[model samples]
Target: YRVHLEHYMTELLDLTVAAFDYESKTPTYLLTQFLSGIDWSVGTVNLISSIDLKSDKRITILKALTLLAGECKGELDFLENRVVDLKSQIGSNTQLHLRYDKNCDYIEKISDTSQLCTRLYCYGRDSLTIESVNEGIEYLDSAYINNYKYRKEKTIYTNIEVASDLKTYAEAYLAIYELPFLTYKVNLADLAKREIWQHEIINLGDTLRIYDDDLSLNVKVRVKKITKDYVSENIYLEFVNYLYLPKFDNIAEEVAYLSEVISNIVSYDDPTKVSVDAIDDLPTIL
Candidate 1:
């Protein structure tokens, strides 16, 4: 018996120092690495940090690998032998080893690949047992043609409110399909003294509102994860809103209401609510 294993390997190439700064007199370095391999063409590291310490510290490189895995399409494994520390000030350039393989856990299962071309179709259900014309094919003969006849009535359909306008509906549909998330870094030095003492600046479950002037986009999100760099005193916040899957009864009405709310806040020029260069430098605002 002949079996083929569909597998790919991705490796982090030479590390380059992106940023070097001093925080509270502590020397800090931020390094970036380019990842390339069989499956992945080119990938850039989002954030990296390195700092000098009195004693040697073991840093787990899995976090970086894990982030890369999420961006990749299929399953991937890190090539330990290929990983090399081209340049470093903290310690020796020894080859790092990983105990377990890293793979992309985020997988969206679909019923049929061909049905992806069709906009109106129901998914997320077993196609084999259920009679579904949108399932692509029932059975293929020697000629590679489907034996079953295509019938729209036989297929399971999802009942959703159809918007009148195509453009407006498209925006509403996309918003529900692709939920938005925000990620940004926060520096401690830019924050006020009183706000600095509070540890819940980037804490999870905290609600945040982000406004983009150029795009005219306003998103209300909750902090999902917080990654803090103690040496550099920099905190990375990842926020996401679980507001997808609109109510089936009034999709257009909901979309219109949301649009109105965003419009009101952006157009409102309330002096008390809006700040014009008030440099108190609160950590929560940052």
Candidate 2:
């Protein structure tokens, strides 16, 4: 006679094996499965109960896990604290004062005046005592069109003789070659491609934040020049002198020390000068 323990063994106990195997293994198999299952089940239940299962709490947990698994080798809280300390250092080290005036029309008028044709005349006597005149003139077209259909661009070439009388010219030429503006290529591949030109995206005197991956630094800059390559679909943005972001823990202190060293040479006591002394002062804790 065969007796089936269907409901008890299979349903209640959650047995995977058939009745034949269960009957053969008897108490050994049942005891092992029961112990292992209960051990894992209890541990999992305790873990879940320890953590709040709310949406915000779960998100926080996920973020912590992501940070722990990421390539950066530091505790999240420690990294945050480090960032705060660096910001404090930067605040104490650098003074950035910006002033804006409605001078666009004035600048345009000056530019137009500078591009006006200027004629120069030099007189010399010929062999037969006949008077001869030499004239040099240059100008930018007043009606120059700049649009999607027609873009006007020009290249300027200048030659300076390094004669004994032109010592300043020679020095300037050498200095130009050594300058970062002439040597550095601000080619950012990721930001090179855009739907519109740089000028359309950002106007003159606009502040920009640029990041250099190689140096792992951020620089605050202002737009100065924009070059576009229509055929290559590449845009190059040139920036004015920039301030580097505080990177090291002692960078602010170092900057302060340097400023002190040159304090005598640099002065801001003029009546017209804007006071930015409060920029570096830390807030007092209450």
Candidate 3:
């Protein structure tokens, strides 16, 4: 029997909001508004009631969800009958360690330094420059520059106008780029079949401890992506150190997904032959 199928969270990136403005509202309230704006009927917002947020801008539904998720340290879980539950502190501090010597199927570790930068030049609304503690048009990561014996610089533009806010934004941007991106792709389906490892199905955002004896590496990472094959019942997972740094959508990924979606489109000349449910599943072709 084939069990792996589609989930409701897959539609997040396709939804967009032209504009949204909210001030001093709880994360639950903002999440409800975002779901309503996208006409999504499956999500429940009960996490992070203590935190209040304020924002006024246009953003994608996925981006909005990521922002809120980061604020709450939460993850979205798809439940029965298309229900999505936002759960806070979903990852446990008690790490589940995975090591090659412990009978893991396959493991590939990668550290990406292509996005690292020691300095960032930022431009805000109407030539508004950051002139606070770190003055000038650029913000520098002095520690990173000193350690590397050189500087890698990049430019960024934002809609924030206030000087203090711009400095904060620039610092955050610089921090993300100052460190190398690290991830591990593992195929642990075989291990999952074992009695000791079959306690629960691993989902996104779960904390995992990965240990490599040969490399002398030990680190805890969050589940970043999951890929499953319906036919083979095989599962693949990607773990990352920085969850919010690398965006989920990129040009190559977008193009590949679009191609797959187009290939899946079933074409029929006679509309009378298609059922209402089947018609509803088809994407609108312009």
**Best candidate, lDDT-wise?**
3
Residue lDDT tens for model 3, 1-286: 6465766666777877656555666767767777784546546665645554434777777787777776665666655454556665444444577777774567898988788787777777887677555644355553457667668878877666666666655654554456677778887654566687675457666766778887676876777778876565566878876423222234344334334433333235542122223322322111
Return the TM-score for each candidate structure.
0.25, 0.20, 0.54
Write the residue-wise lDDT of candidate 2 on 55-170 in tens digits. Answer: 22222222322222121211111121111010111111122211112101111101112222112111111211111111122212212132223333232222212222122222
- What's model 2's overall lDDT? 0.26
Candidate 1 positional error at 254, Å: 17
In model 1, which runs have C-alpha deviations exceeding 4 angstroms?
A: 1-118, 123-175, 178-200, 212-217, 242-286
lDDT at 137 for candidate 3? 36
Residue pairs with clashing backbones, model 2: none
Model 3 CA lDDT for position 162: 68
* TM-score quality measure for candidate 3: 0.54
Query: Which tens-of-lDDT digit does each residue in 1-286 have in candidate 1?
Result: 5443321222223222222222222111211232322222322222233322221332223333332233221112222344322211111122221111211111111122232111222222222211132134332111111223432121222222332222233322322322122333222231222464443333344554444444343444444444554454444555443332223235456547545433332214552231212211111211
